[model samples]
Target: MTKNITTTDFSAVKAADKAQSYLFDNFCELLTRVFMALEEEEWATQAAWDIAFGPSVSDADAAWRLVAFQAETVTAVQPLSVDDLLLHRMAGLMSRAVSATGIDALETVRSRAMHCIAQAPMATAAAVRDMAKEALSTIDQMLEHALVCDGDDMSVRALPLAA
Candidate 1:
């Protein structure tokens, strides 16, 4: 015999799907902001400095900040001798910041964006676009999985009562 579903079950599933969609939308916005920030070399360099070391706290801090900020930003994804000390360090610092924020989805997108930036001498507009597209696609897949789970729950709730 075929089983039947109910409306209550469907409603629950719909609610869960909505929640997942909301999360994905927020994640996408964060990715967009990061992409815009990296579009210009000056902005990217400033971000790198901020990530590496927080705002200067003292007189000595200002000198260190100047040195680090003056260092060249690595454009290539692969490491160069100079990159090993600077860009790689910046990547690690930014990754740590993302992790500390406890937003796994945003962190993942940031990591991917950083990877693309690290590969080239300064991130190109095309590469940024590609990374943004990929990040948005991944968010969609995550939302789909949440929606499927919601649908399954709805089916369970819709079952007929035994008499």
Candidate 2:
């Protein structure tokens, strides 16, 4: 099992000053918890939101606000990491979960993630480390598939194939 993720630095570094892969890893970690909550059925009911985020401050409305604050943190990074599809998907799911009136949207996102996990290479023995490794490798593969305007822009191109 992974250590407490709340201890990890969740800061949003500037795009040019940070590595994309690093940001991707952090996003993966956060979503992993959200998906686990869903997969375990803790997020299947209305009361689960407060429990997933934290205890309520006096009332349920306070709990919802706290959850919204956490969701905002994830959504704020979308524009900064615009190139990553998975990141956007996770962020959107999180945003919906926080604002959603019913559990249907959350369940749909959970189902989608479960489907991906079922098809993943490590589906049989899918440890967190294995999933993290796969996430990193996927980023590398995305690099290989990136579109480049020209070979002159070295920043975006993958390794050239041998002649």
Candidate 3:
């Protein structure tokens, strides 16, 4: 005869899943907020600076550690200047904390965005908008994936009750 599992066992699993879900949700929300803040029209340059040196961590050393962890994927793009490398480092840290693949794609788009910004004075307005669109699309996808994962986890925990 098959032995039935106790409600207590299921409850424990549910609790663990809920905690993981909460952590992922919070991380995703923070990423979205930062992305939105950086995307504002007036704060473009400042946003880049903030992304590189924001007060997200306790100190520069901590920030550097986070960046170093994800450096490999980010450094695969074009050779970056010191300043550009710093920004890429920040992007790497942010991506590792959220979704690595999505964030890596975002960083590539961001690099292109910076290129467009640098050339804005000589380029057509349409070109600038296109670059911005690419960055925003990546951010949108990241947020969507985070939300879906959160929902799926919560649903898994609720399945027994629903049944």
Highest lDDT scorer? 2
**Can you write out model 2's per-residue Cα lDDT over 2-118, one digit (the tens) per residue?**
877556444645443365554455556554544443333223234544345543322434333443454456455543423343454544554554454333444454555445444
Each model's lDDT comes to 0.36, 0.41, 0.39
TM-score of 1: 0.27
After the best TM-score superposition of candidate 2, give how far the Cα of residue 127 lies from its true spot, in angstroms: 10
Q: Which order, best to worst by TM-score?
A: 2, 1, 3
Give residue 150's error in model 2 in angstroms.
56
Which regions in candidate 1 have their CA more than 4 angstroms from the true location?
1-7, 44-133, 136-163
Error of 2 at 72 (Å): 2.7
List, in order, the clash count of every candidate structure: 11, 0, 0
Indicate which candidate wins on TM-score.
2
lDDT per residue as tens, model 3, 1-163: 9999865458866766565444333333434444443333114233443345543422322333433333333434432233333333334434443333343454554565456445444333353244334434544544454344346532222111001
Best first by lDDT, ranked: 2, 3, 1
12 Cα displacement, candidate 1 (Å)? 1.1
Native-vs-model 2 lDDT? 0.41
TM-score of 3: 0.26
lDDT of model 1 at residue 108?
Answer: 58
